[model samples]
Target: MKFTDGYWLMRPGFTARYATEVADVRAEADRMTLYAPVKHVVSRGGTLNSPLLTVECWSPAEGVIGVRTTHHAGSVRRGPEFALPGAEQGAGVGKVRRDGEVVELVAGDLALRVDTAQPWKLEFTAGGQVLTSVGERGTGFVTDPAGRHHMLGQLGLGVGELVYGLGERFTPFIRNGQVVDIWQADGGTTSEQAYKNIPFHLTNRGYGVFVNHPGKVSYEVGSESVGQVQFSVEDQTLEYFVVYGPTPKEILRRYTALTGRPALPPAWALGLWLTTSFTTDYDEATVNRFVGGMADRGIPLSVFHFDCFWMRGYQWSDFCWDGETFPDPEGMLARLKEQGLKICLWINPYIAQKSALFEEGRQAGYLVRRPDGSVWQWDLWQPGMALVDFTNPAATAWYIDKLRQLLGQGVDCFKTDFGERIPTEVVWHDGSDPERMHNYYTHLYNRAVFELLEQERGEGEAMLFARSATAGGQQYPVHWGGDCESHFNAMAESLRGGLSLGLSGFGFWSHDIGGFEGTPTPAVFKRWVQFGLLSSHSRLHGSKSYRVPWDYGEEAVEVTREFTLLKHRLAPYLQRAAQQAHATGIPVMRAMVLEFPEDPAAATLDRQYLLGEDLLVAPVFTDDGTVEYYVPEGTWTNLLTGAQLTGPRWIREQHGFHTLPLLARPDSVIPLGADDQHPVSAWADGVELRVHAFADGAERTVEIPRSDGPGRTAAFHLRREGGVVRVTTDSPHAWQLRIGGPDGVLHSYPAGTSEAELRYES
Candidate 1:
């Protein structure tokens, strides 16, 4: 993706044409167009032999400016464009004006300015201050030695600007000085390749850029030009949007508003999920042992997942249970459901040759075919596997019907995996570009299954343990970190990826508890148990070995039990966070930089993250439980212990297996459910509101959502005036009020009290 050999020269076998001064401008109410010749047109003959690049500018939504630069206008457009649901509602909102040499298009508070008299430059500004600019020679049309065209654009990077979020990158959390390609791959947590590749990045300078291309978008973030973030695509045109926000969270809100907000997952899906690990030998008896083991240890297990090998060997995606192992799939699921556990089945979009539905799909023209009209077959994950052509409506319906049969047998959701290993030499049913479909295919594949689940189970109840995604894929809730090794290093890398994905636009995310590649040591498993249980979604999964807590040690079992119980008690707090994600685009698990944008120390920290707006979580990554984390300026109280720490500094401490640094921010009220056995209950029934470090004259209103669905919540109003903390609520259910301090629970109110006033010492 890098085009320059050094700072001054281009690499060999490359030709570049840059857009010069604008020759003419046509202004409209909603958009503006600039005709720029590759050379300066001092004379009329100067424009004769030069390529005239067509630059179009408009606004998709308020505070978002889109610019498209094209070399040829006759290239055939393709299908599989990103779904911008807000574009229609935001139409005709842009205002264009011409002031001397500067022409500006203003949408909301953001404006895009282009100077017709100067060298080609597009400057984005807000409040009359420049956010970023595409400087001279920034818009380019290039050709490689093979005669393929590429269009690229570069935006200026400031001196101390830091870039983040290109879809779950496990490399350094700061993406500056890295070459990133927006291509989906099945590479695990250790590689440069990512399962989710979104061509969007936000900076510390209060703006974000989203390349509106589903195909490959190569980005050189302060790498090629050293002072610019350059992006290129192998096509006739390049379109990207610059979204402006004075804050990082506001930037994400605007970006996600243009794309899509995440769907609110059901409350039970936030509880601990136990999965039969991949490649492990398991049947009904093994599942019963694991489920019963958790119950005996007093651990709350919400959903049970059956990974691959639920079907017969070499017959993946048959949607049929292997009779040799699970002799009674329906009966087994019924018994599990009776024990208050939901069911999840592992599935992918590929149909193996040995599967019963493969022939049916191939005969019905539902499979992707090569140029010669033959099914595109591969032997990578499964023998003779063919991809389902989701572009074909009939194929989507046929595939959904197969899954509907499993839903009939009591499956609650699906682990939609392996949509990253797509082929580019095949033809789609709707004639989409093959190169484009390689990454966009996962969108269709996940949407078809997610929509089916939404139809069967009501809205806010459908969830997927999905692995691969692209831009706007946040509509499908609950994606997990894929295929990590069982080690302390991989655990930290997984946290980095999750935080990065959160900054990208995803709301909820999870990871394998004891890792997925090897058997974790007891220390690793116990530490991961604490980390995983603290994630937005929690799951225990692995490969070749079972992830039962007792397999590691007794301490692991105790650690898993304590955290699972703790997570269940934290359900009301998490549900409110999920509602925030559904309303705005803020993620449940936020990075430190996203929460503390003004703190210089938080710009590069990746080892720790904010669990919600209130609690800061720093996962222990060492075997000895030694962790060093940063806390912003506040008197923060630990939710676990009664320890209070003041910061704007780094704190290093060694914790036992049962605890890590989970601190509640100052002046925050966290809703705690009384029941610690289940995530789904009447959340307002016997709830305890923990008020932490409420400063004088600080007041807050907390809304606890109902467990059944959205739009139903219990409201609690709290105010701290002088010494007495007053609390009032509108719910009829029983509740208690607890004033928390360095010594936990300084004052407690009785149950069934709708209003109370208690005096507390600061």
Candidate 2:
């Protein structure tokens, strides 16, 4: 990906060309086209010999500009395009000035300057201040030794600036000085993420550069030149979008509007999800005991997940329950459903030789094949496993039909796993380049299953416990970090990955509550239980061991019960955050930097996160329960103990079993549901609105969406104005309010309680 030898020389065997001068410019209603020659045409005869690069610029949505530069216009673009959001382009209103050896094109707040002479430079400015620059020989066309052509672009890096978010990277928190290839692979948490994305990074300087490509995008971030971020892909055309933020939140707002925000998952999906351990012994009795044991221990379980053992060994994704273990799956699910629990089973896109449908897929050309016309096989996860070619329409339908059968037999949702182990040596039915299909395959695989879920289940009810993802995978509801060791360090790494993924434009993310690998000790499991229940989606899964709380100890059971109920009680606030994630691109679980950009401590604190912009959750990673956390300049009150602390300083303290560093930001009105007996929906019926640290004149609105349907039907927003806090309702249903602070009891009305009074204790 990096072709530069150093700061001064280009690497051998590579030719770089850049637009030196804008020969002419044409402006339309919402677009601008520039004809720039790589070399200045001294005469009319010179223009005929050199290639004129065509750079077309336009706005996809407000505050986001797209630039498509083409060296050759007639290249064939294959399938596998990113499904970006549709937008209405606004009219342009800037001036274009051209002078000898210099040309400047200005549109609204964006300005681009092109140098006409040697070492061509394209500088982008906002309000007359240089933001980033494209330097000499920075943009060019590349053809690999295999005859694959590609367009490359490099932009100048600024001092002290950092890059973040290329989709679920497991590398360092900051993405600088790294050569990242955007390809989805089954490389675990230890490697540079194979599940890479083209969505570029938003810098600390308040601007983002996103590559508009679904195929493989290789990024050399400060690794090649140490002063430039170079990105390249296989094609003659390069398309990218420059989204202006001026703030990280604004950048995500503009970015998600261009790509699509995630859908808010169902209320039940937020509760604790318990799974029978993968590759462990689990039958009808084991499932019942796990469900019954949680109830016996007062741990409110919502969803029970069956791992790969649900199907016969070596025949995953057959959609048939293992008859030896689960004699009657339909009846078992019916009984579990009678106990008011949801069901999830493991599945993947791989078709094993032992699977019944392998022959069907092989005969129908639904399976991926190598160049020699033989079915590509791998024994990595499963023996003789072949990948389902999701690019083919009939192949997708065939796979969906099997899943539909499982749905009819009582499976609620599927944990779509292992799409990252895609083969790059095979050919897709749609003729997509194999290397490009590596990452793009996940998008198609998840899309097929997600679309099917939406069809079978209702709109808001569809959710996938997905593992792998690419660009635009945020449309799917929940994705969990793949596999991790059952240790405190892995717990922290999982958090780092989630925070990183959230920065990558993903909304809802989950992980194995007690880690996925070996069996966790009581201390680790208890600590992980608290952290897991607080996540957007909580699941207790592991390898070779049961994740049931009592398996560790009674204390672990107690911790699990406390946090699970606490999460159910906090559903009102979490769902609102989820709705915001659906509306904007902001993640439900956001990094501190996303919420507090001005706070230097927030930029480096991956161990802690601002949960839904209100609560700060620093999961205890050590057995000692000592936590070191930072709060932005404000008064933060602990949500559990009501202990208030002043921020802009680091606080280190040891916590108990019932407490962690969960603090609510100043002026935050955190809404809590009343009940934790069932899932979130039942609790949201009568919610208790808890107003925390209501700073005078600092208006804050808490919207609790209706649980039944869409469109934000039933909700309440509290606004503090002129020393009075007003709680207004959007739902016509009657509601009651509670005030807990220095104030005693607020006046409560019927379904629509628009006003309240708190007795201020001064």
Candidate 3:
């Protein structure tokens, strides 16, 4: 993807024809077209031999702009294109004016200027200030001898600007000076590869850019060119969107609205999920013992996942219980469900040669084939493995029938894993270009499984513990950060990845609760318990070791119990945030920058995050129990101990094994459900709304949903109106409100209390 030899020289065997200057511009009602030649046009004869690059600009929505530059207009677009929502058609074009070689196009309040002369720049301006600009040689169309095509674009990187989000990246939280390739790989969390590679990045400069392509995009961020962020793809046509957030969170909101907002997963999905560790020997009796042990230890376990070995070792996706191990899968699932637990099974799209479906897929043309007309086979993860050709309708139906049978056996969800190891040399069923199908394969794979879940389970109830995704894959509710080592640094990296993912518009994200590889120490497990429980989704999974709390020690079980119960009690507030993520595109586990962009201290803090809009969680990342977290300008109260703190400063403190710095923002009302042990019905019987440290005469309203309504029911509204705290619960039932601090109790109120006085320490 890097084409430059150094700062000044182009690599050999490639010709660079850069857009030099715009000769003329034609303005229409809804679009502005520019004709820029690659060289100087001294006369009409000069325009005859030079290549005139045609550039088109238009406004799609308020604060959104689209630019398309083309070398050859008549080009065939291949299959496997990203499904982008059409721009709001009412995007009217307004006035156009031209200076010497600079032409400006105005659409509403957004203005785009094409600098034809020096450096051949494309600049976007709002009001009168410059937002961002693309410098000289910023856009190009490329083609290679092998019939491959590409489009390249480079945008300017300003001083002190930081870039974040390209989907669940495990590298440094900030993406500056990193070369990010939008290609999916199973290269575990420690490398430059990523399982979930999204072609989108948001900057601290208050605007976001999303490469509107699902295909593989290679981004050389300040690597190839020192002053620019360059991205290139293999295709004739390339399209991208520049979304004006004005704020980082708003940019994500608009981006998600365009692609697809994430769905709110079922409340039970948020509870602790216990999985039979991968490659561990387990039968029905073992599963029963693990489930019963958690119950006996008083640790709530909501979902029980059976890992890959559930099926025959070599024949995954056979979808049949190993007759030798699980002779009665139906009965086993029934008994587990009766004990109030959901069942999840590990599954992937690959079919091993031993699997019966392999022959069926081979005969039906449902498997990817190489250039020699033979089925593509490999022996990487499984023996003689052949990938499921999800591009084929019959293949997809064939794949879903297997899942439907699992669903019929009482399995609730699936851990849709391993769609990242896609092959680019194989042919797809629909004749999709192999290169284009590389990253997009996961989209089709997850969509098929998610759709089946939606069909089996009703709306708003389906969820997937999916691992790989592309641009529009957020529609499937929950995704987890991939494998990690059992260490503190890995835990911190996972949090950074999760926060970065949230900034990228992914609503729900989880990681292996106690790390996915090697046994974590009791202290590490206990600390991870608190961190995992506070995440948008929580799961206990691993490869070589079990993630059971008791596996570590008795104290680990106690830590799990404390956090799980706390999470269950906090469901009312968490579910509201989940609903917000569904309605708007903001994530519940938000980065510090998203919540407090104006605070300079927040832009670089990746060790902690804002849980929804009110809570700040700084997870302990050291074995010594030390935590360094930042609190924005406010009076924040510790949710664990009754400690109050003032900030805009970094606070470093020592935490015990069971506690970390989880703070509630001032002037916020965080609803706490009455139940703690169970999450399935955490919708609340009668909620106790704990109004946090509000300023005197400052009132806040909280919504309390009816118990019978959806998980996100009722709204409680409290506001400081007329120097009085006016409180109203949205539900008709009687709701109780209480005010308490480090000193015992302050006051209490009934549901119908229309007005109340603010209580504070005298």
The lDDT values for all models are 0.91, 0.80, 0.82
Model 2 segments more than 4 A misplaced: 23-29, 39-52, 87-108, 111-119, 142-150, 196-198, 682-685, 712-754
| Number of clashing pairs per prediction, in order | 0, 6, 14
- Model 1 C-alpha lDDT versus the unseen true structure: 0.91
Order of models, best lDDT first: 1, 3, 2
lDDT of 2 by residue, 232-341 (tens): 98888899977777788888887777777887788789888999989778889999999999988888888999999988998866778889999989999999999889
**In angstroms, what RMSD does candidate 3 have relative to the true structure?**
2.3
Q: Which stretches of candidate 1 lie over 4 Å from their true place?
A: 741-743, 746-752
lDDT of 2: 0.80
Q: After superposition, how far is residue 288 of candidate 2 from its true place, in Å?
A: 1.0
